[model samples]
Target chain A: MRQTREFANPPVVLGYATIAGPKEGEGPLAAYFDKVINNLYYYEDTWEKAEQKMFLEVAEMALQKASVKKEEVDFFLAGDLLNQIISANFAAKSLGIPFFGLYNACATFYEGLILGAMLIAGGFAKKVLVGVSSHYATVERQYRNPTEQGVQKTPTSQWTVTGAAAVVLGDGEGKIKIPRVTVGKALDYDMFDPSDMGGAMVPAAFDTLLVHFKETGLVYDYYDLMLTGDLARFGQQILVKLLQENNINFGQRLNDCGIMIYRPEQQVNAGGSGTACSALVTAGYVFNELSQGKIHKFLGIGTGALLSQVTTQQGMAIPVIAHAVAFESY
Target chain B: MAIDKNEYQKTVEKIKPRPPVLKNCVLAFLMGGFVCFLGEVLFHFLRGYGLSEKDSYTVVSVVFILISAVLTGTGIYDDLVRIFGAGLIVPITGFANSMVSPALEHKQEGLVLGVGAKLFTVAGPVVIYGILSSLIVAIILRGLGKL
Candidate 1:
C-alpha cells in the first residue's frame, strides 16, 4: 500500500501446481498443469465444493512438489471470485495452515504472491504458500447467472477458467525468484457494463505498468515477457493502443494469461478470466517456459474487476486493480 | 498519470468487440418460426382427436410447456436456447426454462428459501407484468363493452 517494493533477498518459487477442469485441460496450456481434471465437479456434488477441492488439491501438490511437509509451511495466502472467498477458506480449513483470504477478484494471484514473497523476504516466514482458485460454474452462479442457464455470452465477455493454481514461495534452491512487486490502486474510469471487465480494467493495468517502470527503472523490454491476467482478447488490444498513445511499446514480448489459457474456438468469448486464469498460466505454462529457459525474466500482472453482482446492478462503475510481480531466474 | 475517464471509455468502445447481432437475429427468426410451426402441427393433431378448438389450443400449449419443463430438468433447454438465441425465448419454452433453472440451481439451498422462493426469480417479472397489463386491458375492454 505504501509503494512498490524491491526485496533485498528475493523469495524463491520453490514449487507450483496447477489443477484444471475439463475446459481448461483442453486448453493450449493443458500439458503444463500437473493435474488436468476432466470433470468440472472434480468428484464433488456441487461446483462450489469442486472449487474448494481443486484449491486443496493444488495446495497439497505444491507442498509435495516443494519437498516440504504440510507442517513446515508457515502460511496459506489464497482467495477466489466467490463471495467471502469460501473456496480458499474452506480449503484452508482442511489445510490446517494459518490463512489469509484475499478479495481482489482476479488480482488475488498477484496480491497473494506479493504478500507471500514479502513474508519470505522479510523473514516473517520460511515457506509461504500462495494460491488461488476459480470455477466457471461457481462464478456464474454467484456473479452472473445459473450455471446451466443458456444466456449466451457476448463477444466482450470472458469465460471464468475452472481451475486452481498454487506456488510455494520459500527460501530454497528454486529456479525462479521474485524480485519486485508493484501494487495496484483500485482504479475506475467510469466504464460501465460488468460484462466488459476488460475495458474497465485497462486503466489499472496501464497505471501499474507505468508505476512499475518508474519504480524499477525497467523499460518495456526489461523483462523477456510481461503478462496481464484477465485482460483477455479485447482488453489487450485496448491496452496496446493506450501504451502506444503513451509512446510505450512492449513489442511482441507482451501477452495475457487470459489469451494463453484457451484457444479461439473454445467458446470463451474474450479468452479466459477468473482468479485461476492467470495463476494457471503462470504456474503451469509460464513456469514450464521459465524452467525450460524459453523466457528468463517474466513479469506477471494480475488484473482484476472488483465488481459484485449487487454493485453492478446498482449502476456503479466497475472498479479494477492490477498488481505486478517481477520474477527472474537465478 | 491521472486518467480521463471519458477518454478511456472512448478507447474501450473503439476496441470493444460487439456481439453478432445480425447472425443472432437470423437464427432467432428461423428457429422461432420453426417452434411455432411445430405448435401449429401439434394443434392440427389435437384437433383431429375430436377435441374442441379451445381445448386443442390448451393441449398444444400444455404439451410445449411440458416438453420445455422436461428439457429444463434434463439440463438441455438452456443449450437449445444458446444456439437458438431468442428462438426459444418468444415461445413458452423460455419461460418454462427460466422457472425451472433457478429452482434446480437453488435446490441445494433447500426448498423454502431457495427453490420455492427463487422458482420465479426470472419469470416473476414476466408473470407480474403480463397479468398486470392483461388486467388493465380487460378493464378497458369491459368499460368499452368489448368483453
Candidate 2:
C-alpha cells in the first residue's frame, strides 16, 4: 500500500456534477450547480428517497459529462449522512455499479475523493466516480429532533445542506489534477455537545492541515485557496485561532464551504453542513474557479464530526476527522 | 493522543456560540403568555355559549392541543418554535406537538408498530406520572373528607 501522503501519479478529474435542493439553490453559489431541484421532495415520496434519487441523478450526470458509460467506470465510491448510508446504497443498486459506501459524516465527499483518487493513482482502476449527498430533512430527522417537532435550534447549530455532488476521476486528460491527499486522524477533545459541531471539528481540521503542510513542505501562500468542508462561521474562527497558535496562517484564503454556500440572510444559523456541504461547494464553486483559470492551486479539506445521537446521549466525546485533497488547475 | 483537557475546554468555551438566554427567555415568555391568552379567550367564549366553566376549560385545552397537532403535522409549529423558543413548548400546545411530531415522523414504519408503538416515546412518562399524581391527589382529598 502506498502510505505516502502525496500521490506520485496524481489522478485527473475528468468531469464533475452537482445538484442541490431548493434552499441550496437559493444560496449564493446556486448558479454553479449543474442542476438545482426547486423542491426538496424532487418528485419523491420521502426525503430519504429523494436524496437517493439525487445521488443516482448526480452520479449519472457526472458520468455523462465525462462521456463515460456506466460500464466504463470501475468503481463508485459514495457516501451520505443517513443511517446505514441507505441513500448511497440505493443509488448504487439502481446504478448497478461496484460500490464502496463510506461514512465520515459531513466530510464524506473528501473521503470519497481521497479513496477514488487513490484507486486511480495506484492503477487499481482506470476510472472511478466519487459521489456524496445529504438531504436536510433526512439528516435532521436522523441526527436531531424531527423536522415537525418545532424544536428551537441554538445559534451554533448549522443547517444541514440539502444536495448531492459527484466527480469522475480518470487516467485521461482533464483540466484539473488531485496530486496529494492527507487523511485525518480521529481527534476527540472531549467536546460532548452535538449542537456545536463546528467547535468540535476545528481541532481535527487543524491537525490534518498541519500534517498536510508539513508533509508537502508547502507554505500558506502556496495555494490560492484553502477550503474546509463544513466548519461554518464558528469553526472557521476556531480554525483560524488554532492555526495562528501553531504559527501557520492562511488569512483571507482560508474560507469554508459551509460559510460560502449560503447567504447571510438565509438564516442558516452557523451556515450549512452535511456531506453535500463540501461536495456541492467544491464540485460547483471551486471547480468553476479552477476551470475558469481563476485559481491555480487549491486545497480542499473535508471536516466531519463523527457523532451519533446514541453516542451523544451516552456522554461520549465527539470524535472529528478532516481529510485534505490538493488540486491544481493545469 | 494526550490532549490537554483544560486547554481543549478553554478553546471550546472561547469559540462556542453562546446561547442568548435573555432573548430566548423573553420570546418564550411572550409566546407562552400569548398561547395562554388565546386559551383564556377560548375558555370565556365557550363559557358564554352556555358551557360550564369546567367544560369550557376542557374544550379550550382540547382546541389548543388540536391546533398544535395540526401545526406540527403541517410543519408550521416547528417554525413557530424556532422563533418563540420555549414559549411554544412550555404551553400545552408544546406538549401536543411533542406527542404528534415523533409519531408523524415514524409513520413510515406503519401504523401499529411505528405510530402506535413510538407514539408515547416522549409523552409516555408524562402520561404515567400525570395519572399517578392525579390518583394520589384524589386519594389524599378523599382521606381529608374533601372529595
Candidate 3:
C-alpha cells in the first residue's frame, strides 16, 4: 500500500510571515520579534530592500523552527508580485541559495508549494522552503497608479492582500507527508471584471474540481475540505452556485481563505488578493487544522485574471483563469 | 545599422518648427478649464439626480474616464496633456487621463486576453481593494461595536 495519509512527510508547516501597510497597525519589523528583526530595517534606502528584509525575516522564522542552518538547506524557492521578482531574487542573492523565480500573479504560493514539493519528492533535494511576498504599494504601482492619491475602482476589483509569508517543507520529526499532487486545470473566463475575479475563476475551479474527481475516481466527499484562494464573498457565492449547478456541492467544507482570513467588514469588499492571501492562510489556518487531525484531505484553488488595460487597449477582453490542487493527509 | 547623417539632417530640416509662443497653449487652457468647470457643474447636477456628493464624484470619474478614453483613442488627449499638463490632470480629468493612458498603451495585446483583461491594470487593484476591504472592514467594525 502507498500508506495513503494526509501528507507524505507532511512537512509540519511551522512559522508564519507578513509585511503590512500602515493600515496593518504596525510594520512587520514591529512584530513581537522586533529585537531580532530590528525595526530599523524598515528605514532601508529603498522599497526593494524593505521587501527583501521582510522575506528574510519570514524565512529565518522557518529556519529557527527547523533548527537547521541556512546553509543546510539544499535550495530556496521564492517569488513576489514585482516586475523582476526583485525581493525574491534579492532574498535569494542575499541568502546565497539556489533560486527559482515564480510569477502566477497572486497564485504564487500554491505554485511555489507545488514546485517545492516536487523537488523534494523527486529526491532532487532533501529540505526546501517555499514562500511568496507582496506589498500593496509595490504591486499597486506596477499594476495601477501610484498611491499618492486614492483611486476609484469597479465592482469587479479585488482588494490586494498586503502581506508576505513563508512556510517550511521537510521530512522533519513530527511532520506530515506530501506525496500526491494533482495539478489543477486552469479556467480563464476572460470576463474583464477585475473586482470580480472569483466569478471569472468559477468556471476554472469547477473544471479543475470535476476533473480531479473524474481522474481520481473519487466523489465529492472524497476530500475533507475544498478551499479557494481570494474568492471573497461575491466570488465565493458564485463559485458555490457554479459547483452546485454541476452537482458538486462543496457544502460547509468549502471555505474561501480570502473570506475566512480577515474578520468581517474591514471593507475587503470581495476579499483579499495577492500571493500571500492563500499562502498565509494555508500556513496559519489550514496547516493548523490538518496537523491537529481536524481534516485529512483538502483541495486548494488559486485564481487570477489575465487582463491589463494595455492589453485591453489592443482590443482585448479579460480572460480569467483558476488553478486548483488537491492534497491528501497520509 | 549606421545612421545616414545627411539624410537625418535633411529630415530634421524638413520638419517645421513649432511656434515660439504656443497658440494651442491658450486654447488648451481655455478648453480644459471649461471642461473642469462643466465637471463641477455636473457634480452638482448629479446631486440633483439623487446621488450623494461622494457618489457624484464617483460618477464623475466614470464619465470623465469614458470621455477621456474616447478622446485619447482619437489622439486628442495627448495633445491636451502636452499643452495643459496640470490643467488636464486636475480633478476628474486627470483621473480620467490616468485611467485611459494605460489602456491605450496596452491595447495592442488583444480583446479577450489583453484590452478587456487589462482595462483594470491601472485601476483594477484599487477597485479590487476598495470592494474587498470595504466588506472586510465593515464586518470588523460590526464585530467590534465600532460600526
- Candidate with maximal TM-score: 1
List, for all models, the DockQ compared with the true complex.
Answer: 0.69, 0.70, 0.02
Worst 10 residues of 2 chain A by lDDT: A1-10
lDDT of 2 by residue, A1-330 (tens): 122266677899999999998999899998999999998889988888899999999999999998999999999999999889999999899988888999999999999999998898888999999999999999988888878887877788899999999999997678899988988888888888888898888888887877887777786689999899898999899888877776767888999999999998999999899999999999999999999999989999999999999999999999999999999986
Interface RMSD of 1: 1.4
For every model in order, what is the iRMS?
1.4, 1.7, 20.7
Give the 10-residue window scoring lowest on summed lDDT in candidate 3 chain B. B8-17
Task: For candidate 3, please provide the TM-score of chain A on its own.
Answer: 0.84
Q: Residue A234 error for model 3, in Å?
A: 1.9
After superposition, candidate 3 runs with Cα above 4 Å error: A1-41, A44-46, A185-187, A306-309, A319-321, A326-330, B1-147
Q: Residue B122 deviation, candidate 3, in Å?
A: 12
After superposition, the stretches of candidate 2 with alpha carbons farther than 4 Å from their true spots are A1-4, B1-3, B132-147
Cα lDDT, model 3, residue A314: 71
Please state the error at residue A91 of candidate 2 in Å. 1.0
User: TM-scores across all candidates?
Assistant: 0.97, 0.95, 0.63
Give the per-residue lDDT digits (tens) of candidate 1, residues A39-144. Answer: 8887878788889999998999999998888899999999999888999999999999998989899999999999999999889999999999999888988898
Query: Model 3: how far is A141 from its true place, Å?
Result: 1.2
CA displacement after TM-score superposition, residue A219 of candidate 3 (Å): 2.9
